[model samples]
Target: MKQNIYNFFLMKYSREKIALLISGKASFIALFSLIIIFSFLADKFFSLSNLTNILDLSAILLLTSTAMTFILMLGSIDLSVEGIAGLTGVVGALMVKNFSNSNDYGLLSIIICILLGAIFGLLNGIIFTKLKIPSFMTTLGLGAVASGVCILSTRGYPVIITDQTIRGLAHIKLLGGVIPLLFVIAITINLLIWFVSERTILGRHVIAIGGDEAIAKDLGIKINLVKIMVFAISGAIFGLAGMLLVAKLGAGDIRNPYGLLFDSIAAPLIGGIAITGGIGKIPHAAIGAITLTILRNGMVLLGINPYIQQSVVGTIIILTVAITIERKKIGVIK
Candidate 1:
């Protein structure tokens, strides 16, 4: 009877099922393990205040990393997030009731900021698809252009937001102050992405393209359209992240998104998303973002040198990609 039960269980969970389970659970396991370690190392780590702080910090990173997941799944990279985010933040702040501008567009400014992000993202897709430019170079050049625009708009000054409602968004709490509204927004966006990725035809096409672009094309998947849409969606998400940052800071500076690009890219990679593509889930990226936030928070609490913290993160990213990347798919290491 035991043997039969064991055989039945084996039949219920095939190799693919087991692999998927591992991939999905790995990030959570790592997160919990770190939590345990940090709890022991830092007395304040498990405190409610510190935990809330970690979640607060994780919000922006979580959003950006979620955006990056789509592009990364297609085996492409986006280097434009930081610049786009900074530009959007500046635009959002300037359009709203602000110190630098008389225009009080209020909610319209938020929509405009998101639209601007989408437009830039669309530009990325057009240039890459129509011009035959590689995503790496295309996004890099576009990011630079965005950065220049941001500087030109601000003229080396920060714009202080005067919209009380917008500024208050950063402070709203939920669930007895254990959760911030910003975190709620981030999670909601992630859930939307998850639904699209797991339920829609576009999601299937995306996965197909990532698995093998050549095969996807042969199978009649609209590669260019899908890629463009992915980029545009990513851009919109980054734009929202920028606005959130501005709301939190109550001001918009061109330097606001300084380290976002790295954090977004690193989070997914650390979460075991293969850089080679086609092998990750949205939840994994979230887990990775939370883990990174915890790591940074713990480091600060433990009095670790800031420089060393960066080095440690970089090393972990390298090791993660080395271990998780499917080298066979890449064909060559350049």
Candidate 2:
């Protein structure tokens, strides 16, 4: 007994739980470690200019991942981010930059685009919960539908920016610094997500529903309403992402980084959101997003091929899930 007790504290697994909670998922520790390592291997990787550049790059993924964190927390997943964001971006760009040059409504256009995204969320929820269809297949099918809308809207053409007001967001500096307004918007959205996930009754319901539907129902929670609301929330955020993307890139290319849904999910999973649902926090995935953006951006500067980048991301995702997922929570892998 004495030997066993001593060995437990001396063992590597003892600090594992604490580390997992503090900074494990999304390899937060590894990100910092790499920051130090790369500061030496590569020039100016840690310089203020380069660091600001990394933050700017991370904002988009963080925005998407934060919304994704909500969906995953409910033990649900939305694979439709790419299509939704793409649609939102194209719509917003066209609304503000029509060839007639009469489409400018400024910030109101942002609000309308966001609401449109929420409509998609509502559609996903109603189709899944009301129709009694599984969300997995529902989102997959809707993704295709949304993608088709993108094709029809742009006809495969990218929307260019003539609106100086919208373009200013992408180029303007905060306090005369390199920190674009884009990162600020992304971070603000994430702060709101943290509030919703941590402070409200609906947030509690989301956690409960994800953890166990039967149990949540037994507790008299409005399981269906909560589930539906989350999908809408995810959609609304994606809508904001669309507007932001257009502002950031000054164009709405149908085939743009709109296909980043995989990385969005991968970020949350790596940050320790259980695939089974009801088991993770929004902030965790946000951190994971930054970590991933760091890794990818670093890889780019290091001249790594983009194809191999996906492979590396895939490996990290598998390993993160293997280490962090509570497999017993899931009854079957299928």
Candidate 3:
């Protein structure tokens, strides 16, 4: 009887693994299909310039997604990306380089602003873990506070960035257009994140904590500290992303990119990261971010109805998560 039960469980586990493999393979197929559709519909979608445009976008979204994966892996949802990105972008614009005769702040000012974001994340983690508040509510409240700070700091106006060092990212290619320094920076950050997630004692502890917090604590893991570290890492990366956007756009609007949180969620979800946590990879989320940016860029080049883009992306996110999520882990999705 014992042997029969063990055999039955092994077969069930193998079947689930097969399903996961198929879903993981589908995301790549979706990327290829999106590309083919664009080429067939849009004459200029395959141009070299358009390809670079896609890479530029992938740079920012990838950073945001990479940050969120850490939080998601811990079975937590963080809506703080929007406010952190917006505020930090605003702060960096106001304080980095030269800004419309308003002020002249150097890279040191930028560093200070980045550190502030990390502080915000740290506060959030404390509230969520120590206070025993639900992660969702804690992050939502903290995100609002960050947004309020944005309004107060900028006084409801856009700040223009005019520093050559910062603007270098958006313009000027070295090695005669064969390579871009901006892309190098973005890819470097992603690889560093991958290394931490794949090869550190702390990283393994984090995964173990996410797998089962109760068991992890019984095994002598410092659960609170790991959770706090995850949020801090997220905030710091988002600070970098905000700075990148300022360099890219050359201006920081108070209402810029009003809905970054959705993209943050979508990228990881589409990349095969589990919403229920403990099973996603950081590098995989970058793949999803690039795939998403390609879809958006292709649609614009193809002149698909501008309004249709949001709905299409929303639909894709839902479908991808449905196919990729481990249903057994989340028996009751309310």
Candidate 4:
């Protein structure tokens, strides 16, 4: 026992291990730091109501950011997130008991919306791979297409949900209303995705491809399939988020999911996922989501200007990416 204890302490610590350890905790550190600063800056920051608000606000952002993390890990960006979310929210609204339609699909509506998101993602993957288009261009074009569809469907009007059961789902609370059911659902799903990313072949391939696509291709990795799966998975999560958004807002508008794209991307990046790709964890996205939520929530509590808040978030993104980026690996710029 004495020998074992000594050996454990004597174990050599490599620089790589140290670096990884620090990288993994960077987001947590940022989250804690924000909490501490906010607690001091805003009297209500640490209150139960405020904390609950932060968690509730984080639900959708958490789901979207976690999905975005995988896309970033694949060295790709999904500009279609906002458009897909808007479209899916509208679809979910229209399909459910809504003022715009008599259709009351209930849970089935959610499933179709999620599946629609997956189909869009699959299309994005196919176009990106088979058509040899850059992910940026393909996703951007698809996003615009989605937005157009959304506008056409809405015809410049909002769809108010009339389904009491569906709307009530968002308002359901646990622990005497201290915790929201929607946030719990988001956390559960995030855990599932984290497991997939850490323990599955697809997840491993995503990291490998992002790290070095040339080597991954040479080593028998199905690059296209992995990329497609990642995007599809993200799309499905985005769909779920859209449905929940509709439930919470009791209406669906093209602008319902406004700022989601920015929040999703910023959360992952702020959490230590490199924009350049191939180096981060799913949990980091969750942490980043909470951090961003708290930052915004605290700002509002402190009476900060809404416009300046946007600037702060933008600056944080730029700074975090600069700090965590794998600059040595990316030797050239276009």
The sequence of per-residue lDDT tens digits that candidate 3 reaches over residues 195-306 is: 8876775676666665556666766768999898888888888777777777788876546656678888898888877776666678767778888988888888767796
Tens digits of per-residue lDDT for model 2, 116-140:
8899989999898999888888887
Residues 112-231 of candidate 1: C-alpha lDDT, one tens digit per residue: 888898999999988988899999899999989998998998896899999988998889989999999999999899889988887777777676676678867866679999999999
Q: How should the candidates be ordered by lDDT, best one leading?
A: 1, 4, 2, 3
TM-score of each: 0.93, 0.90, 0.89, 0.93
> How much is the lDDT of residue 327 in candidate 4?
69
Give the Cα RMSD of candidate 3. 4.7
Clashing pairs in 4: none
Which segments of model 1 are wrong by more than 4 Å? 1-21
Candidate 2 residue 90 C-alpha distance from true site, Å = 1.2
By summed lDDT, which 10 consecutive residues of candidate 1 come out lowest? 5-14
User: What tens digits encode model 4's per-residue C-alpha lDDT throughout 1-334?
Assistant: 5334323322322332353466678878888998999989899999998888889999999989988998998889998888888899999999989887689899898898899888888888889988999988998899889989999988868899999888998889899999999999989988999899877778777767766677678667789999988989988988888888998899887788889989999998888887867778888888889999999998999999999999999999988877767665677965
Candidate 1 TM-score, true structure as reference: 0.93
Give the true-structure RMSD of model 4. Answer: 5.2
Cα deviation at 283, candidate 1, in Å, is 1.3
Error (Å) of candidate 4 at residue 210 is: 1.3
